[model samples]
Target: MATRRDPITWFDALNVVLLTMVAAACVIPMIHVTALSFSSEGAILSGRVSLLPVGFQLQGYRTVLESAAMMRALGFTVYLTILGTSVNVMITALGAYPLAKPDLVGRRLIWLLILFTMFFSGGLIPIFMVVRALGLLDTVWALILPGMIATFNLILMKTYFSGIPTSLAESARMDGASEIGILMRIILPLSTPIIATLTLFYGVGHWNQFFLALIYIQDPDKYTLQLRLQQLITDGIGYGPTVVFGQADDIPVESVKAGAIMFATAPVLIAFPFLQRHFVKGALIGSLKE
Candidate 1:
């Protein structure tokens, strides 16, 4: 008798099809944009470029790198991302430590207040006013301070810390270690996964900053990478007048816009792989634990 072959499951087949479609949806656009950015302007205008570059050239990258404004914006964004992510991680780690402890006084009220902010805010005008009142407007601090510790990440960190054994902290205190010492030596060492995850979160947010820079900053030199890229895309495509005139006209507008996107997205993409293991491990730390 001939052996019977196993039939393919319907759900498995459906899942494969769905996931492949989703992957293509994301990857195809990026590949298309990259190809367009490298292709000649005539090829782009004629719709000859797709996943492959037609008449490949580095003109778009050259245009982007050569512009003083673009370089300035890129530098500002790098500074902002580094400083802002540092502040975010430090503040969040410090804040979450005490909140995670069950014996801490007034913890519930503090947590409640933090949670409340997640659902409600003082509105954009009030926030802008506060930034202005504090003399943070048009400065690097304006980009960093207003969003210092995202509530969701705070709660996530707190929950992760809560899952740790309280006996560890108690033992550290018995060993003559101070609270900061325990955090530095004991808690943080074990909390690497969550820390890496939060760093990635904060870094990506700071890198993509735009609306805050738009509202608070008046100097063109102060613009972040995303804001400058936005200006390029909009102005180049004639959404409105170019913010920096005469500079964009010489380059192929579409190519430059695509190049700017790839430039902005590359760092995050490169950083993510190193931290992927931690991110995955940390993501599930607090779900089932009461």
Candidate 2:
């Protein structure tokens, strides 16, 4: 027997139309930027480029790639992302696991204290002073250590861990498994979805890290990719003076900026696909309470 389906209403149609417009608003600019990046200087300057390149060329990318400063910034950003995300996930998980245990003494008080930090903080100057006092200024640790365990990510992880059946942990404990052993061998393996979700969250944060780097890192050589892109866009600094001087005709300032934007954005776009399958499920599950 065929079941009768509800007929589409005006609200449903309106929602579809609005969502499509929103999606296009987000996507069209990216397409235009990509087109600008690939199009010839003449095409871009004449406004001939839109969603598609008018005269395809790779000179902009070539200029960006040939620069030593941009390459160093890219390497440093990659290193920061990897190291920061690893520490973030590990520390968040370890903290969440213990809090998830119902038998843990003072769990509620500990949770309340942690939760208090979300609404209140020591402000920028105090944090900067503490970092400076600790001799973390002008060092990578200044960026990583200050904002290590995000309160929101920790809460979400704890909620996810709480949703897991207690029987699993009990079974591991009966076999004389330690807390660390249970977390590593049983809980973490089963929490892959949330782990992957948080990994993406923390990874993107680290990748797009700019203000922190700007504040802590005074050395131009240690600039992150975003900072380098900012320099390119604002100062018309095309990689270096030599590249700019030689390729000025082939790669215009606007084209270089577009290419640099794409370069900074590409890694996150590439990595998101691998984690997309788990992202929605993990986010939804973690946000739910038992």
Candidate 3:
């Protein structure tokens, strides 16, 4: 049923080779980082490590877990990701659902406001002031609240909603279903793909957050993993003078830093394959818009 294409096209051949090179270029550094994380500093510095560790060890992970501050930060990051992502999904769904309906009163004006905010804003100071006024500053809510719902994500969701056959929703309404009922029964089941994709996006953003945490959280105990990891790397030799830092039984310092990076990324990477099915569907979420 499919027509065979000529294999002699010059650009097509070159494109394949170019894409393979790009894949290698991207994958190699990640491989190097993984290899180095499991290797000893001496082995790494001596150029003994490559795609694989010269001296295999689990000391990096051990050291990372042993630190009180690092452990605390890890816990906080996990808590934030779970809680923040839930809020993002719920709020975005609520906001996007009404906007997606063509018959909703003042839909255009509401959409215009959302779009305006996407392109222009009151800037950092005003947002910070509002956060501070709400007394969310220095609290866990600060990070979550500031970026709870993104306009761009809402637009993608709205577009997805628009694509769903209106008759499906109308049929529900004709069957004595309320707006809320229609949304729950008709819309949500069909919206799983886009939801999963946006969940991944929002979850990753929360996991990798740094700026707000750095600015709002002054307490050392409340720091997120990213902030704590940053301190670990920057405070490398300098958090010294009085403290030799790493306890004698603990793993080497650099190894721990490497391990932290590895661990933080592990959850996000592992989550992807599980949501891989939804991701393919998500590619088409906004495609039908406009």
Candidate 4:
């Protein structure tokens, strides 16, 4: 006999409709922006573009790509994201591994101290002073060192590590495996889900880094993508040799803005697909207790 399925409830139907609407709400704007970026000047000015590009052209992208300053910022942001995310994941994993052990001295106190940072922190001026005092100003370290270990990600990692069976670690210990060896061989190997999740989180954070770069970096050459994008949108700054004199007038300002936004956002969107399989599973598992 075939198994009978239960009929869908009204509540389930309502939830599906609501979630679909919410997803559409989030996606439609991106579609519009993309369309705007690709649409021709005439179509953009006439407001003829919506979900799809009308009279499609690559002028906006060509203008963005041609700019030296924008290219530098893109390169810098890419480097920062890769380096910063590596540091974040490694540091968080190392820190979480120790805290996951039940016998660690002052574990509770140490956790409390770390937890305190979540609720409170030295304000912006204090943080700026600390950064300055450390002589990290105008350097990439200014951006990386201060926010290396995100508190929430650390907590997630620690929780996930705790859920790993102690029997594995015990067996390793019996085999004369050092704590570091155990972590490297056993704990880390099993913690892929959380690691991947935290990697995505930290990667996104570093990719979007802007305010810190603005505050700490005085040199325009060191400016990040978001910062440069801001200048493009607000100051109406012309980019590249092509934009000089009357050439910039040929490119519509709105299209350039849309294009710039899409360019800055594209990397993260491209990266998400690779990590999405691990992301939800990691987040849910890490958040729950065994």
Q: Say which candidate scores most in lDDT.
A: 4
Instruction: Evaluate residue 263 in candidate 1 and report its C-alpha lDDT on the 0 to 100 scale.
Output: 80
lDDT of candidate 4 over 1-290, digit per residue (tens): 22358666797789889999999999999999999999988888887999999988888888888877789888988898889989999989899999999999999999999999999988999999999999999988898999999888888899999889999999999999998899999999998889889989988888898899989998877889988877777654455323221256566767777899999989878887899998888777755754
Determine the C-alpha RMSD for candidate 4 after optimal superposition of all C-alphas: 3.6
In Å, residue 67's CA in model 4 sits off its true spot by 0.9
Assess candidate 1 and give its TM-score to the true structure.
Answer: 0.92
Top candidate by TM-score: 1
Cα lDDT of candidate 3 equals 0.80
Report the C-alpha lDDT of model 1 over 1-290, residue by residue, as the tens digit: 22357565787689889999999998898899989889898999999998999999898888788778878988999999889999999999999999998978998898898889999988999999999999998899999999999987887799888878989999989989999999889999988889988998898899999899999999887999888888777644564224633444566777877887888788877887898887777666645543
Clashing pairs in 1: none
Query: TM-scores of the models, in the given order?
Result: 0.92, 0.91, 0.89, 0.89
Model 4 CA lDDT for position 56: 80
Writing each residue's lDDT as its tens digit, candidate 3 over 155-254 gives 8888888778999988888889998888888898998888898898888888998899988888766789888767666655646211223454434655
Residue 181, candidate 1: C-alpha displacement in angstroms: 1.4
Model 1: residue 73 alpha-carbon error in angstroms = 1.1
Q: In candidate 3, residue 164 scores what lDDT?
A: 86
Ten contiguous residues with the weakest lDDT in model 1: 239-248
